[model samples]
Structure formats: structure tokens, C-alpha cells
Target: MDTANTMIRYVSPINPASFPSLSILLLAIGIFFMSWFIVYEVTSNRFTRNLKKELLVSFFASLFLGFGVLFLVLWVGLYV
Candidate 1:
């Protein structure tokens, strides 16, 4: 009976959505960048003349937003 108890304890639960694919990450990144780029493009054209001239900076910002949103969404989706 002790062996059965240990075996049961050792057993692990499998969840299908536990591991999301790289594609999801990529999609999330795309969403973030696009969102930033869209807003930036509009504002730059509307107000500024030089338009900030910072693709790399925008890219990083997009990446941050993208990853953060992705993580939050994934976490909530999985748990809630």
C-alpha cells in the first residue's frame, strides 16, 4: 500500500495548454509592434516633422509591450 501511495503522488497532471508554441509568441510580438507602429505613424505624421527617426527604439518598445501583453493574456487564459 505504501508503494501505491508513492506512485499516486509521483503521478503528474497533463494540461494541453501548458506549453504554447513559438508561433503564439511571434503573433503577440507582431500585435504589439503593429499597435505601436500604427499609433506612432499617425502621431509622427500629424505633429512632428522629423518623425523621431527611431525604428530600433520603436521595435524595442513594441517587443516589450508585445511580450507583456502575451504573457498576461496567456496566464489569464490558462488560469481563468
Candidate 2:
């Protein structure tokens, strides 16, 4: 049992505006990268003929990453 390793770590409360800023930053980055990936996929591969499917996959991937980061921030409390 590592008692020393477990404790309430917090320097301050999360600002109300920080959440929206994080969301916006996350979305902007997601869109930026998704655009590049979609363009690259379509241009590099001839088999990927369906734009809808490419978009769907990219959207899901962005969502998954965003949600994953959100969950981690919520559960772990980013900032110690």
C-alpha cells in the first residue's frame, strides 16, 4: 500500500471559462487534423471512393479522442 502516493491534489478550482476554451481548442485542432487526413486519404488511396465513409470515420475518431481527453480531465482532474 502506497499511502504516500494517494492524496487530494489541487491547486485551485477550474475556471468556468477554461472549459469552453479547452473545448474550442480541442475542436479546432480536430478539424484541422481531420481536414488534412481526409484530404490525404482521398488523394493517396484510390480504393477509398466514398467521401461519406471517410468523413464518418474521421468524425468518429475526432469524437473518440475528444471524449477520451474529456473523460481523463473529468476523472483525473488535470492539474496537480
Candidate 3:
């Protein structure tokens, strides 16, 4: 038997509560950007689209939103 050669490792889990401020900030920024994006889309002319502006806005909105939601879930102890 080679049981003596076996090794065990322990890893500490992340605690979202450690950075509540960061989570809140991200959520707020995400919502703000998303709202503006919606308004822009609704009011802007389809035929006169500005691809650069739209892409930039949408990218930031999605990025912040994804991270914000993820952090929020983790903060609430939903380890999904």
C-alpha cells in the first residue's frame, strides 16, 4: 500500500460580504448604463445608426450587468 504518498489540499471559499460596496457600485453602474442604452435605442433613428457608440454602450452595459448580478447572487449566498 502507498497511502503515505497521498496528499490533501484545502481551499478557502470566497466571501462576497467582504466587498459589499463593490457589489453595490457595480449593480448601480450596470443599471444606469442599461437604462441609458434603452432610451438611446428607443429614440435613435434606425437608419442613422452610430455603430461605434452603440457597440460601446452595449458592451459596457452587459459587462457591468453580468458582473453585478453575479456578485449580488454570491453576496446573497446563492452559490450558483
Candidate 4:
């Protein structure tokens, strides 16, 4: 008879308590950028659109917002 042997590994999750400042910073920056993007969209003239600038702003806004929310969710002890 032969027996199989297997090894188990343990992985640790990120601890939000370790970097609370980072979480707050990301959230703030995300909110600021999102607000700026919204304002720009509302005030800019459709006929004189700057695709490059608009794209850049929107990209940063979404990127930061996404990360920010993710961090916040993790920080709140809600693992998903």
C-alpha cells in the first residue's frame, strides 16, 4: 500500500489597521478627482472638447475611485 503526502500553505490577508493613513489618503484623492471630473464635464463646452484632457481626468478619477473604495471596504473588515 502507498500513501500520498500533501503540504499545506497558509497565506495572510492585508491588514487595514496597518495602513489607515493610506486608506484615508486614497479615499480623499479619489473623491477630489471624481468631483473635479464631474465639474469639468458639466462646465466644458461640447463643441470645444479636449479628448485627451477629458480622458486623462476620467481615467484618474475612475482608477482612484475604484482603489479607494476597495481599500475602504477592506479597512471596514468586510472581506469580499
Q: For every model in order, what is the number of clashing pairs?
A: 0, 0, 0, 0
For model 1, the stretches where C-alpha displacement exceeds 4 angstroms are: 1-20, 46-54, 57-80
Q: lDDT by residue for model 4 over 18-42, one digit each (tens)? A: 5466677877888888898888889
Root-mean-square deviation (CA) per prediction = 9.0, 8.2, 3.5, 3.7
lDDT of 2 by residue, 6-73 (tens): 97676546564476566566666666767767676858667746777777767866885685467447
Ranking of predictions according to lDDT: 3, 4, 2, 1
State how far residue 43 of model 1 sits from its true place (Å).
2.0
lDDT of 2 at 13: 67
TM-score of every model? Answer: 0.36, 0.43, 0.71, 0.71
Give the alpha-carbon lDDT of every model: 0.58, 0.65, 0.81, 0.77
Show where candidate 2 strays beyond 4 Å: 1-13, 46-80
Q: What's the lDDT for residue 27 in model 1?
A: 58
For candidate 1, write residues 47-77 as lDDT tens digits. Answer: 4634355576477666766655555565566
Candidate 2 lowest-lDDT run of ten: 71-80
RMSD to native, candidate 1: 9.0
Residue-wise lDDT of candidate 3 within 1-76, one digit each (tens)?
7765785664536545554676788889988989988899999899977889889988998999888888788777
Mind sharing the TM-score for model 1? 0.36
Q: How accurate is candidate 4 locally (lDDT)?
A: 0.77
Model 2 Cα shift for residue 24 (angstroms): 0.4
